[model samples]
Target: MGTNQVEMCPVARLIFVVYLLVTTCSASPPNFVLLFADDLGFGDLGCYGHPTSITPNLDRLAADGLRFTDFYCTSPVCSPSRASLLTGRYQTRSGVYPGVFYPGSRGGLPLNETTIAEVLKPLGYATAAMGKWHLGLGQNGMYLPTRQGFDHFLGVPYSHDMGPCQNLTCFPPDIKCFGHCDQDVVTIPLMYDDIIKQQPVDFLDLERAYSDFATDFITMSAKKKQPFFLYYPSHHTHYPQFAGPGAAGWSRRGPFGDSLLEFDSTVGNLLSTLENTGVLNNTLILFTADNGPELMRMSRGGNAGLLKCGKGTTYEGGMREPAIAYWPGIITPGVTHELASTLDILPTFAKLAGAKLPMVQLDGVDMTDILVNQGPSKREAMMFYPTDPSVRYGMFALRLGKYKAHFYTRGAGHSETTPDHDCHIISILTPHDPPLLFDLESDPSENYPLSLQGRPDLQALLQKIQAVREKFEATMEFGESQIDKGIDPNLEPCCTPQCTPKPSCCQCD
Candidate 1:
C-alpha cells in the first residue's frame, strides 16, 4: 500500500506542475495606462493635500492604490524629463539636454535610445501616445512618436504656448502673460500619426479631443483582446491655460484651477472607459507629472504646497512630483515615503510584461517589488540635473536616503509684474563649497540647511555622496546635445490645401 501511495504522489505532482504552466500561459498581461501631466505641482490634487483644486477621480485613484510621497522626475523641464521617463536614462545620456526642442529644431531624441514603447511593442503590446510629444520632430518628421515604436500618435509637437499667438486672449482675461507673448512664433500643429490634422489647434477643444481618442483606442484594444500601452501626456496645467466650457468657471483658484478641474474630468473619463470595457481590474494605471508647477505664472500656475521654489530650478518643488499607482487586486492601497522616479517606469513595466530590457546601461532601477508586495524600494538615491544650458553634465543635487545635498542652488526668474519680487534674487546661481545638506524627512521644503562645521557623521555623509557623484561622472559618457542644433523652417509640419503664402501655409483648421 505504501509503495502504491509513493508512485501516485509523483503522478499528482507532475499534473500539478502542468496545471501551473497552463494557468500562467493563459493569463493575459496587464494593460498599462500612464497619465502624465505637464507642469503639475505636488499639491495640485486633493489626494496630495490641496484644499481647493477638486480632483475626485484622482483622489479615488489614491484611495484604491499606492500613493508615493517622494516620487521625482530626473529634470525640472519638459523635453529632458520626458526623455528620461521614456528611456529610463538621464537626459544627458539621451542627448536631449540643455533645453526643450522647438518646432523647427533639426535634431531630436537620438534613434539609438530605447523607449518604453519600443520595449513593450515586441512583446505584443499595442502602443499609442496621445498628447504632448515634445521629444522632437526632426527632418521629414523622423523623430515624431510614430517613428519611435508608437503605432498611433495624436497630439502637438510641442507646448501650445510656443505658437504664433503666445498670449491668446482665449485664455482667462485675468491671467497675465510673461516674456514676449506678442512674438510671431511658428504655429503649433496637432498631428494624427505623421500627418498634420490641425494647425493652431483649438486649445479649448483639446481636452475633449484627447479624451475621445484615448477612449476609442482603449475600447478597440479591449475588443481585439490585445494588451495595450497608452501614454497620455496631457497638455493641461501648462501655460496659456484654457479650460473647456464645462470647467471654465468651476474653480476658486482661477484659470489654473479651472484647467486642473478639466484635467481631472479627463482622468475620470479614462477611468470610466476602462470600467466599461471590463478591463479595469486587469489594468495598471500610473498618474504623475513631468515636472513641478510654473510658479512664474503666479496665480495662473500651480501650487507646490510647502515645497520651495518651482519649475526650472533644482529645488524640491521643481523635481518632486505627485505620483499615484493604481492596479486593482494587485497593489495595496496606501502611502509610501520610499523614494522613486519616472526613470523606474520603463524597467518596472518591462518586468511586468515579461519583456527583455535594453542592452545598454540604464540609470533607472526596477521598482516592481515596491509596487507589488510593498517591499523596500530598490532606489536608494536620486540625482537632480540642471536645465541651465551652461552648466551641463553631473547633477546639481543628490538625495541619499533622507539627506539631500544641493551642490548648486538657483530659482526660476519671474516677470516684472510677478508679485514675488524676490524671484530675481533667487535666480542667481550659487555654488556651495561643502554642499548645502538638508534632512528632507524633516524639511521637505528645504528651508533650513544643516551645518557641516562640527558633525563628523554629517561630513562623512557628504563625502559618501561626493564619492557616488564622482564615480558616476567618471564612468558616464555624455551624448551630443540634439536640442542645441540649429532650427530649420522646412522641418515644420504644414497641412494640405495650402494658403496663398509659403511659410504662412501653416495655418489650418
Candidate 2:
C-alpha cells in the first residue's frame, strides 16, 4: 500500500504540471489600452485631491488599480514627452529635443526607431492610435502613426489649436496667443487612416468621436479574438478646453471643469466597452498625462497641487504626472510610491506580453514585477530635460534617489507669453554656478533649496550629475523639426469653408 501511494503521488504531480501548461497557454495575453491626456495636472482628478473637478470615472479607476504618485514624464512639453513615451528613450538620444514640432515639420520620430506598437505587432496585437498624434506631420506621411506600426490612425496631425486664424475672440487676446485664435486656428483637421477626414474639425466634437472610435476598436478586436494595443492620446485639458453639447456646463469650475466632465465620460464609455467585451479583467489600462499642466492660464489651465511651477519648466510640477494602471484580477488594487515614468511603459508592456524587445538601448527599466507582484522598482536615478532649450545649462534637474540637484533655476509660476515673432522668447531660467540641491523626500514641492555649504555629500552628488550631463550633452543631437518653431499658418492642413469657399482641386480631402 505504501508503494502504491508513492506511485500515485508521481502520477498526480505529472498531471498537475501538464494542467498548468494547458491553462497558461489557453489564457490570452493581456490587452493594453494606454489613455494619454494632454496638459493635465496632478491635482486635476478627485482621486488626486482636486477640490472641484468631476472625475468620478478616473477616481474609481484609480481606486481599482495601482496609483503611482511619483510618476514623471520624460520631458515637460508635448512632442518630446510623446516621443519618450513611444520609444522609451530620452529626447536627446531620440533627437527630439529642444521643443515640439508644428504641422508639416520636416522632423518626427525617425523611421529607425522602434515604437511600442512596432515591437508588439509580431505578438498578434492590433494597434491603433485613436487621438492626438502630435508627433510632427511627417513629409508625405513619413512619420505618421500608421507608418509607425499603428494599424489605424485617427486624430489631428498636430495640436487642435494650431492654424491660420488670428481672431482676438479665440482666446484672451495677445499677439502670442497661437491657440484658440478663432474658429479657424483652433479648428484643425480631423484625420482617419492618412486621409484628412475634415478640415477645421469642430474641436468640441472630438472627445466623443475619439471615444466612439476607441470603443469600436475594442469591440472589433475582442470579436476577432486578438489582443489590442490602443493608444488613445486625448486632446482635451489642453488649451481651448471645450466640451461637447451633452457635457457642457456639467461642472462648476468653468470650461476646464466642463472638459474634465466630458473627459470623465470618455473614460466611463471606454470602461463600459471593456466590461461589455469581457476584456476588462484581461486588459491593462494605463491612464496618465504627457506632462503636468499649462499653468500660465491661471484658473483656466490646471493646478499641480503642491508641486511648484508648471509646464515648460524643469520644476517638479512640470514633469511629474498623475499615473494609474488598472488590470482587474491581475494587478492588486492599491497605490504605489515607486518612482516610474512614461518611458517605462514600453518595456513594461513588452515584458507583460512576452514579446521580444527591440535591439536598441532603452532608458526605461522593466516595471513588470512592480506592477504585477507589488515588488520594488529598481529605478534609482532619473535625469530631467528642460522644456525647450538647446543648451544644457538652460534648465535641467537630475534626481538620484531622494535627493535632486537642479543645475539651473528658472522662472517659477510665470506665464511665458510669446507676444509676437519679434519678441525675445520669454524665459525665466538663470544659470546656477554651484547648482541647487533639494531632498525630494522631505521637500517634494522644491520650495526651499538646501544649503550646500555644509553638505559635502550633496556637492559631490551634483558633481557626479554634472559629469553625467557633460557626457550626455556631448552626444546630444537635435532634430530639424524640434527647433522651437511654431507652424507657418500657410502650412496648416487644408482650408476651412472660409479659407477656400469652393475648393475643387487643392486639399479637397
Most TM-score-accurate candidate? 1
Clashing pairs in 1: none
lDDT of 2 by residue, 1-509 (tens): 00101122445445544543543355467789998998998888889999888999998888888898788998878888999999988876677766777765667777788899998898788999987888877556677899999999989877766554333222222222234433433345788987788665655567778888998999999999898999988877888666777677678888788777888899999999999999898788999998878877767678788787678777788888999998775666787878889999999988777778889778888987566656677676677877655653533777776777887656533334323111113455566667777877789888688898887977788788777767666655544435444444445455443555322212333
Candidate 2 has an lDDT of: 0.75
Q: Against the unseen true structure, what C-alpha lDDT does each candidate score?
A: 0.81, 0.75
RMSD, candidate 2, Å: 7.8
Q: Ten residues in a row with the worst lDDT in model 1? A: 1-10
Candidate 2: worst 10 consecutive residues by lDDT?
1-10
